[model samples]
Target: MAHIKSRKHPAARRLNCSAAVALAFIALPGAIHAQQTKPASAKAATEATLPEVNVQGQAQSYKSDQVSSPKFTQPLVDTPQTISIIKKEVFQEQGATTLTDALRNTPGVTMLIGEGGNSSARGNISMRGFDTAGSIFVDGMRDLGNFPRDIYNTEQIEVIKGPSGSEYGRGAPSGTVNMSSKTPFAGNLNAGSLSAGTDKQKRATVDLNRKLNESSAFRINAMAQDSGIPGRDVAKNKGWALAPSFAFGLNTPTRIFLNLEHIEQRNRPDFGVPTVGLPGYYNAALAAKGIVPPSKVNPKNFYGSTSDFENVNGDMVTARIEHDIRPGTILRNTTRIAKVQHEWMATAPSGAVSDGSGSAAVARPDPNTWTANRSRQTKWQKNELITNQTNLTTEFKTGSIAHTLSTGVEFIYEKQLSKTIAGAGTMSPANLWNPNPSDPISGYALTPNGAQSKGDTMTVSLYAFDTLKLSEQWQLSGGVRFDRYSTENNNVMVDGVRTRLKSSDTLAGWKLGALYKPASNGSIYASVSTSQQPPGGSNFTLSATDTNINNPNLEPQKATNVEVGTKWDVLDNKLAVTAAVYRSENTNDLTTRGADPGQIIQYGKKRVSGVELGVVGNITNQWAVSAGLAKMNTKVVAGSATQTGSSLNWSPELTFTAWTTYKLASGLTIGGGARYVDGMVRSVSNTANAATTNMLNVPSYWVYDAVASYNVNQNLALRLNLYNLFDKEYVASLNNNGNRYTPGGARAALLTANLKF
Candidate 1:
């Protein structure tokens, strides 16, 4: 056996999509041709000499005991970090077509309705009280843009909690969500499913794989879906995606893999329900002044145009190579390029109004006194991201200590082009309580406002990590990373004035931890980590000041995470239990400076502390379960006016999720689960006034779901999924100001037919 050696190479220049694809074909001609010319005797000899190719297709149970990580060289249970894994089986059981649907099983995670609606790709997500929308990754590479993600090509989803700066450079203070893609294996396999459900939902997905030779294989996954939301009028969703992948030199000393994906979506966005009162709890005061309360309005009512639409088109390509220099050393390199285009026109809620004067106010449904206003919004943008990462891992022993070390370097370039269109549209105000849909309203027409912007960013990072076996029962781990980032933005306003903004920063991140193994199946660990996010870190768009293109003295937001956790494999290694308690402190957050007008300051501080517990795997030979619970507290310790001591918006205090499945002798399996999210403050103000407190609060809610599957034969199965089992009506998400809300869907059922060969 040969060992892989670590080496450094100059950063590769970025290439266009066509050029990259051409280069890939030129470089892999030998590998591809080898697969095409397969003599029977040669194939037999090659197969006998080559090692077996192993792939984890789909798990039979809902639980996965092990997780995959590029940064760590140890098993997940011994990595001294809090990580959660959602296997493919869980997606099939829940009939989850989108990423949002699959995320319901994870605790401490919440969705934020995007600009267009729940179905829009622009929606954000919060994890452990911090926004992590920009921290999403595919196979450890950054996934840029806000495009709706489908699970048709996903193998598993992993959530790693706490500051992960050491593993990923920059902007991972609250952790990261990584989606693993399905890949090719040396075998012949085909699987597909068709599903139909309420709300006129229809979906089909297929996975096909074939081996071209003993060491080469190709695979593809494709999906198409059309659906509508229950209880919402004219709100529909349609999308399709195709992913193709190829692997060569499988199980050999040198290997190469290529993957390409394209997705397109068109949807009628939802704007959700409106607040009862302007400030929420002012209903009584408004009612006293002759204003109608929000209770009179139905939650399912539609106030937007039927023609409003959101569209997204995305493309991604990845190439990876691995070489084994020796038995305990390996080297790998991966490159990914992606492009996404987004366009949308939405009728957003303007405001709620009523005719009232002090104590004489009396609310009514008259258009003059209570009406809903609509505003048309339109935007067109294009984004491109390119990243290349190379790493080497080696194992060695010095004296009595053994060590596993990993070193990596990465480079990323991202560019965005945006155009803005602004125009006023004619819309007749509808009565708030007794609105008539038949009322004639003028169609909206938008014109370009001469507002355009272009943004570009470049980052170079270097990282190293090591795990030392200090003793049979004790292990020590440490890692560090350095990142140099630069960004430039050029903007042209409606006034025909051009402005340029540029910023650059060099930052460092590190982590250290110690683990103690009480037994082969149990470990206890404690760790501390730190991360930072420079200005424009989230989207690479900077703001300009009068004296400078960008604020030169601005400091990056910093965060510190401290955690202690324990993991145990119970039921004879059939089930795993993990628990952790942690606290995160964020400082140097950007805020307005009251002392100096027009100047921004970095004087804000906030803290989030939580305890989490998770259990997964089989409780019995025929039963499997997955569950998690989290309790968190978030508060601003120091901040500007109106922000000090306030609670972070959308940071719920408690969340729980559970799912369990049982299989019978007759080849039938049944499962059910419930998800609960505690009410949270609707804004960062944390107002204490009784009259306004209720208005600023989001009511808590619980939803239950069930699934039943019957195996018709060795190659066929039927599954039924019941969502929102009790038809619970609740608010799913709200805008920052608490004026608009995205309501949860009503009860719906889906039936799926699955086939495998």
Candidate 2:
């Protein structure tokens, strides 16, 4: 078993933490002095005064001149056990177009680049030892699908680690990511950007907010992009998105909002990268033998073509209503409806095959020989989800006790339908692989003709929570929840047979927590939480050629998580730092055990321990930075033996990211950062063959990105971004099919312009 040992001493750790706090203390006074001394520039004066939009229910800090602070990002921090927020400014500076682009550099997340390549279906992002599995939310509303996420409507990204049963129902033991929308403001304003770079990359985005009245407003945002292969021949991504929003406020005590978003994407796929044994190792040995393997292999020929296909469309509608019942008491209700559809297909390399006699070592490129070739696979899915969440929160003072109580009931209904069609190199007579390079690869099917698997899922939950102030400096919080779920799979028969079944289950979860606020701006906390996941339909099997893998006799994957953390704002709020230590165990773990080449049984038990550290603040008025580090050790304590000690697929043991921005002048900013992930393994198999063992363990890699922007005026700006700055080559995920996976290309750049009119 390989484990990472922490070498820092107790006292040293404490001192480093103290230094961060001291630095924050020094920034407060300096910032105040700067605000009082610097005269307003003409550019700042040219922008009109706009109504404030406070995300945290605060007012004063919502104005144009102030930067969002810990106070403004507190709601999530206070409600969830662990939370992290990535601001809009950071996204713009990074030119993030996908969730992986935004999360790859996050401390606790490592995105799995699937063997299917760049144009293949989007892969998964692991957080705290569990997969995201299409479990994501927009404006605090649940939406599940395999669709890739684009950054057009994103205002901010927030990640909450650990069981979220109190809010999100029946999710993985890991965590969830929430995306906030760009809201409407009472003013005439605009912001947009444009860029063109490598791989023939081009992009444009525009945002507009208008006021309908003192109590009503509307907002619209649009994005478009066109790009080509930045690396291998078969990879490409192109898409566009449009989002419109509206909000109304009858008075100070009541307000309501509605949002509608739509997106469309067309992608050219690239999945596998041929492995040319890296530089020093293979060459030296081969040279000594007076024989050398080619530096690179194309893995394709005139008669063997590789390509990817993609088409995606989605829509979402969300609404929120809130009423201030009294001084600190409020009543709120939120609801959302969403739909998503996707169709994707791609071709990738399959490992070498030996002849029947076992003596033939000749290069096998023809489909008829069965030596080496690419397999074509296709997957399509459609999803619909609707959630209605209502809560009543009351904060009141009774004698010496201050209490904030929140009671809520949430119900969510989700349904998904999907089909997969897969075929090998030799299928039909017309699609036969040409043995000769001079022949054309025509009359062949780019996508295989296969079978379809369908299913429907439903989940219902109810929960309640309360926060009690025990003393001036101490508080206690606790919550409990109950859930019910079920799934039914309808199979499409091959020869006229009913091969399907259904299953359901009920579960409960709870959390207990305590906090000590030594000062108004610092908090030390400890919490114990529990979560549950319904029996997924794919866990069972009933036959050989036909599996009765419908939802049947399956149990929920459950876990208990214990965590300790602290949040401190030093230097009078100029610097903020957060650190945590956590241990989690899954009693009835969910895992897969292969029954055949393309089939598996899913079930198990697992345990994990980890630590996290983060810092976000201004080093000085002219400089700002945010950085984080995370390390975890996860083991299948009790489960299918094959997966016991293997590094969990996308969950890397060590992950780190950092960003720094330096203000060059009155209105100019430049910043750059890097994301690092220690190598990882994606799968576990029973055999010792190279394809089965090595395909699961992918090596480590690093990515670098940079940005530069200038304010033309208070309401307008220009910017440029360079991504994959060095074009580092690496693969994201691999499987036993003898196919190696490869991520997208490198060394690309883009330019953008934003205007507020």
- For 1-757, candidate 1 gives per-residue lDDT tens digits of 2111111111011213324433332333233334444543575577689996542322265666655555888887788888889989887788887777788778889987655321242367888878888788889988776656788999999888888888887775788888999999999999999999988989999999999999999999999988887777667879999999999999899999999999998888776666654334454445454654545357677767776777889999999999998998989999999998987877666345544434543445553466776666676778899999999999999888899999999999989888886653656766666544445546446677789888888999999999999887899999999999898988899889998887787889999999997665667899998888776777666775522213434677788999998877655456677878899998876654454342445567888998887877877777888888777888888765677778787888888788888888788888899888888786676444433212577777889999999989889999999989999988788776566677788898999999998
Against the reference, the lDDT scores of all candidates come to 0.77, 0.61
lDDT of prediction 1: 0.77
Q: What is the per-residue lDDT of model 2 for residues 1-757, given as tens digits with 9 covering 90 to 100?
A: 2211111111001122434544543444334444443232432343336553333211111001121211111243343266667766666677777776777546868654443221243546668777675557777676666557887888777777887665566676787787777888777767777777766778888888888889888899999988765654435678999999998994558989888989998886555543433222122222333443333333232222333467889989889898998877778888888888877765545433222222223333332434334555666777777888887777776887777777777777777666544442342211222323222333445442445556676667677777778885788888887777666666666554655766676678888888886555557789998877665522222222222222354345677889998766544355566677898877644344443232233345677788777766666666677777777777766545465665455567777688877877566778888776666545543323331212445566677878888888777778788777887766545443324455545567777777666
TM-scores vs. true structure, each candidate: 0.87, 0.80
Predicted structure with the largest lDDT when compared to the true one: 1
Prediction RMSDs, each to the true structure:
12.5, 8.7
Q: Which parts of model 1 have CA positions greater than 4 angstroms off?
A: 1-59, 114-122, 277-296, 355-369, 433-443, 545-552, 592-600, 688-694
| TM-score, cand. 2 vs. native | 0.80
Off by over 4 Å in 2: 1-80, 113-120, 232-234, 276-307, 351-372, 397-399, 420-451, 537-551, 590-603, 640-646, 684-696, 735-738
